[model samples]
Target: MAGNSDPLTPRAKIAVTAGKAVAAASRAAGRGSGSVIGGRVALKLDPDLLARLAQNLDVVLVSATNGKTTTTRLIAEALRAAGPVVSNALGANMPAGITSALAGGSEARYGVIEVDEKYLAGVARDTDPKCIALLNLSRDQLDRAAETRMLAENWREGLAGSKAVIVANADDPLVVWAASSSANVIWVAAGQMWKDDAWSCPSCGGVMQRPGDDWFCGECGFRRPTPSWALSGDHVLDPHGSAWPIHLQLPGRANKANAASSAAVAAVFGVPPQVALERMYQVQAVAGRYDVVQFQGRDLRLLLAKNPAGWLETFSLIDPPPTPVILSVNARGADGTDTSWLWDVDYTRLTGHPICVIGDRKLDLAVRLEVANQQFQVCENLDQAVQLCPPGRIEVIANYTAFQDLRRRVGN
Candidate 1:
């Protein structure tokens, strides 16, 4: 409808037009980005709107418990080396949000979507993507979403006969099991830092034997696949054994792992590793993550860690001792309503820093910190939390809703 060369059906055109108007109204009212509500409206009007919108575009779907948004962003950037790309850049990865993104970028040659872990199969079905990148899977949104093994089974069943090339993480036993049914797959040895959720094999329910960089199930013989693409320290080793150094602006080993996966996905679309990585280096942030903002005369570096696995990776990105880390949390609908994940995080690693906790569920985190024997001060809000820290550079690690709240407060 916008600039798409392929004309939408009359009914689909009307639905998309109504969706765009609602989305614009949503933004104008300061409610939020109208992507979700707008897409919902469009779907209600025409049930097949998503598939219609995705027609004629080469699509790539990326799903994982962690790093999906950043990986989606990196893939979009890398694919730009080929042509214009459309993506849900604001971390809206559900059906409605994805529909809105596709509708808006009707003329783009590529559609790189960040599909939520629970919704991956459905999105994959509708988009019929050329490639699907499955990053590591772990427990996230446990109260609302399916368990890790169940999710893996869903993925394995959903992708059984798909023609799409799957770029999967071989380091995660769960992911390996999930993508095993696919006919064509490019295995990437993307490292998994949080191994708690995958200690058992999804294939046989046997205890997984992990030795160094290899994993195998002695009971079932379901071992780690030999990776065609591997992450070797700071370099990504291609199928030809050529090493390409990763020098992205984003920090942490997780982003490097994401880069490895993204490079592999980009290759499926005909973009070479060196060219994809060169273009990916231009992405400084995903949504509001890793954004450094000046607040209260101090530099506040924003980081989003929504679950146990995410927290483990985020801890590695924080500044070393005396930098004053602020931990914020919330039990909103988007945050899974369960504070139990806090207990799973290794708060003891934060023992040497000046820690401040604030959010609707600050007490839950405070109690968890107390149990970990790490001291923390609970504050009423972000302002109070920042006031407790001696200025310079402070790291603020927060869950989903709390991170958005802080972003609004800091005008980031």
Candidate 2:
């Protein structure tokens, strides 16, 4: 994504300077969203800052309901092997965050951005990315992001007009519907574990039939597109049928899928699959998702689960049976105010495992666990939750703010 290959106007330069000043002050004051506010101010002043900065740059945009941040990080790391690559390090994925990241890296020629699912269309319009990676879509922040089908429609409308090549998940019906009309498209069979949001076909509104991994709409005859890239067991299969084993430091089948999706995107930019997979192993953590930190003689493995789909994936990452787990929930603004999504998750999966529920919304989670017939204890403090777990290492699964708070408290 590059602008018109023209110099910035005098007004835009001043706006950038003023915005950076405010961002500096905000950071000095310990405010987390310094980049967000800084970008907002710059956009308000210049209005065309994104389009201006994007001119003459090779840009890749990544967006999805889940795994976007990690996928963006992987793609960014792969691009770094070629040249300077600028990307939003923080998970702030809106237009403002993208603007702030681009503003901070004025010297970089390559830009890799994690665009929010809702803002993908608008941001893509401004940046005009060279390649757009569309990950799986699921229900998230219902209060904030209205509905899943609507978001899919918006993505379809936005991407249909872009000249960029699209790399999308063929397993996700919603992603297939959104990118089907794109001029250039490469589909990847990155596994889709969460099928709750895609039960109804976005194409015909008919109940989708998924006898196995493939899904098709009986009403409209829309079927899962044939994927050029697929995952065979633990390896990623390329279009030529060559399989590459993806060794990621991050644990989980979900992350393996992310690596496969990212490798397909890197290939679009001429990066070899072997090279991309090699660079991905260097990424040990994204923000604070899979970080393991020590707290009061206990090792805490931090995992974030903001919604039902996230919770489902995270549950699979933790060890089964013997290992104890901590569940943290918060109804803060960063996490949607409604904690009802908790009920949607099949917490019964925890069956015989020992669980410690902790956070502002711990009681809500405790109640849900009780109904699921799973026994759990409630501890509002992280330290106490850590003590409740067995010695050595314990897993801490938390939502947005709760996870951030755990990271801060443990100094991770």
Candidate 3:
């Protein structure tokens, strides 16, 4: 395994120093955190910067269509029980971002990386992580990301061999199929709320027979593996059948599921379930996903939901009806150009709540809500939307860029 004593090449050392300079300049200019840009410059100068920086770190890479950022945060916190841990806690999942994070924390004992779904293979190859947590797979960024099954195939092939312990979600057939080829895997029955993408078997292209939680291929007999870790309502059951109540500051069942995966990965690093869960409980939010801030005299809760699967999960986290909900979306480079995924979401669930649509793509969302027979006002901006809502706590659910815009507006 790579260790901190392994010195970087002279070229890599220069690249690292230059990257820091660029990042500092970026932050000084208020252009955004300089992680991505800085990492890009470092990679341009020294292509092997990531592998060099990862030396001497017990790395853990977390990837999924949703919840990876939060799960990454939880796992990093849990691993801190062992020693100082470095992580890309700012939602920077790409190579450039991951490189910046690793370079910044050169002396940290562990690296907990939140990897973008498509870049998992490359990052894993470079980091040689001690543990790789594969959460559920689903359709996201349709215009940019690969098809759901194709990405599964990429994961299956990319991780065909090697020694990293694979912590996978058994509840997701896509995840199970991808991780099955690995020799060392700890399967967790992490709940998969959005099942639209896994109706067929990735193994044989046959119809999947999901009788309750157990799933199998009708043609090839590919079946869901018995999970060593499972979620039992409000508690997570370990391989020994001991149940641990998940009391987290992060709301919703999705977060509880993330806790299960994080605990499993933390265990690989010698952090027991009791200690891991206790450490994870401290993470109240991930990159401002569920942050609440006072805006225009009303408490505005920011919730991020980028894809259809994400939208389903975000809806469950909203404050109950009569508490007005603001839905915002944007079709920017960050948030895939395609807006068709909006139709896949069951927006009727928001019918009872006072709804307001605002964002670059608010008109597109308004049409979807209209089709769902949900009455909503199209606001030009968040200020106007908040002005119409009654005083007190209000929910604001937004996609990628829209969420960032709202976070900036609220100064969160």
Question: Tens-digit lDDT track for model 3 on 36-121?
Answer: 99999999999988988887888999999999999999999999999999999998899999999999886699999999989999
Scored by lDDT, model 3 comes in at: 0.91
Task: Tell me the spans in candidate 1 whose CA falls farther than 4 Å from its real position.
Answer: 1-7
Model 1 worst lDDT run, 10 consecutive residues: 1-10
Evaluated against the true structure, the overall lDDT of model 2 is 0.88
TM-score of each: 0.98, 0.97, 0.98
- lDDT, candidate 1, 46-162, per-residue tens: 989888888778999999999999999999999999988999999789999999999998669999999998888898899888899999888888689899999999999999999
Residue-level lDDT tens digits of model 2 in 334-359? 78888888889999888877899999
- Candidate 2 TM-score to native: 0.97
If both were scored by lDDT, which would come out higher, candidate 1 or candidate 2? Answer: 1
Q: What are the candidates' C-alpha RMSDs?
A: 1.7, 1.5, 1.0
